[model samples]
Target: MELDFSNIKVVGFDADDTLWVNETYFREAEEKFAALLENYETKNKVDQELFKMEMNNLELYGYGIKGFMLSMIESAMELSNNNVPPETITEILNLGKEMITRPVELLQGVEEVLQKLARKYRLIVLTKGDLLDQERKLERSGLTRYFHHVEVLSDKKEENYKNLLDHLEIKTNEFLMIGNSLKSDVLPIMNIGAKAVHVPFHTTWAHEHIAPEEHDNSHLTLNTLSEILKYLE
Candidate 1:
């Protein structure tokens, strides 16, 4: 879809895969986790079971590496029939720490695009996850100077975006969200009368997925963040 952005005053960006390498790390961690518990369960079963644990624990821990780590721990315990060794548990914790501390790798052209967009419109990092971890990654990323605001959402539903727009005093039509998930970044914003550009990441969490037929026709899709410049610039 071709979008006219003359009225887009605020541009929102999702942090994880949209800005940097996130889901890929999680994928790697899951592999390591599955391997750690392989003696107790098959790798495929462990992966399936971990996804279930994550979904069940979403309310309790929200989203982030910490929650994922906890889910892995719980899955390990259950897969092992509660006989998972203490050392293995410790290893799991360390795995999470490694991911949390991993170097931030921004996607191609992300910083350059942000730099350009920041000059013309209000750019904010609109993402959901552990507050401290998000902050840490932003600080480490060195992309902080381009963003006018950095919001960490608990969830990216319509209400959350509405509340944020209200808090920021931004008119619905004047806000534009650019991110990697159609489910979180595109659908809800479009529903709330705002514009969104879905910059799809190769890896998306299953919870954030919807059937292809369910996609609304009103939004625009971009293969890469840099492509946003064509419409916005």
Candidate 2:
């Protein structure tokens, strides 16, 4: 179905997987870390333990680097039988930092699409992550110039969506959110009567991918970001 975005004045986007590469880098680091831990424990055991720790930490730390670092620390300590050397722990921390500091590689056509959309809509970047890390990514991505506002959110719940809409002084129906995650990017905005377009990424993190039951009533799902141009045109 084509979107009637003629009423849309503010176009909010989810930054991480939507605009650039995010979870794939983290997944690579995780696989490497699992390999390193194989020396201390079976890969299956280590993975199971790490999953538990990550789920627990997500409740406290939410998502992003902090939760990932905590998961790494717990995994290392568990696999080493609580005898993990300071050097090994430092190595893990360094790896986590490197993952965050890695250069941003924008998805194909992201720059061109943003450049085109910026001319027609008020663009805003709404992402959840460590502030400094997100800022570094935006700086490196070279697409930051097109956004009118950049929001670093702790959570992408209904309240956050409402707050952003209120701050922009726009009604929910007047905004459109384009993002990769159905859970974070599409559902919340749709709940508030805003339109949403889902642009599925090739590889989504376990946490970011949501099941069909979570689909928004007022949203459209697409296989690629470029599909949105069809609606806009």
TM-score winner among the candidates?
1
- Which stretches of candidate 2 lie above 4 Å from their native place? 216-218
All models: lDDT? 0.93, 0.84
**Candidate 1, after superposition: displacement of residue 18 in Å?**
0.7
For model 1 the TM-score comes to 0.98
Off by over 4 Å in 1: none
Clashing pairs in 1: none
Over 1-233, each residue of candidate 1 has an lDDT whose tens digit, in order, gives: 77788999999999999999999898899999999998988899999999999999999999999999999999999999999999999999999999999999999999889888888999999999999999999999999999889999999999999999999899998999998999999999999999999888898888888998987567888889999999988
Model 1, C-alpha of 221: deviation from truth (Å) = 0.7
- Residue 52 miss distance in model 2 (angstroms): 2.2
What lDDT would candidate 1 get against the real structure?
A: 0.93
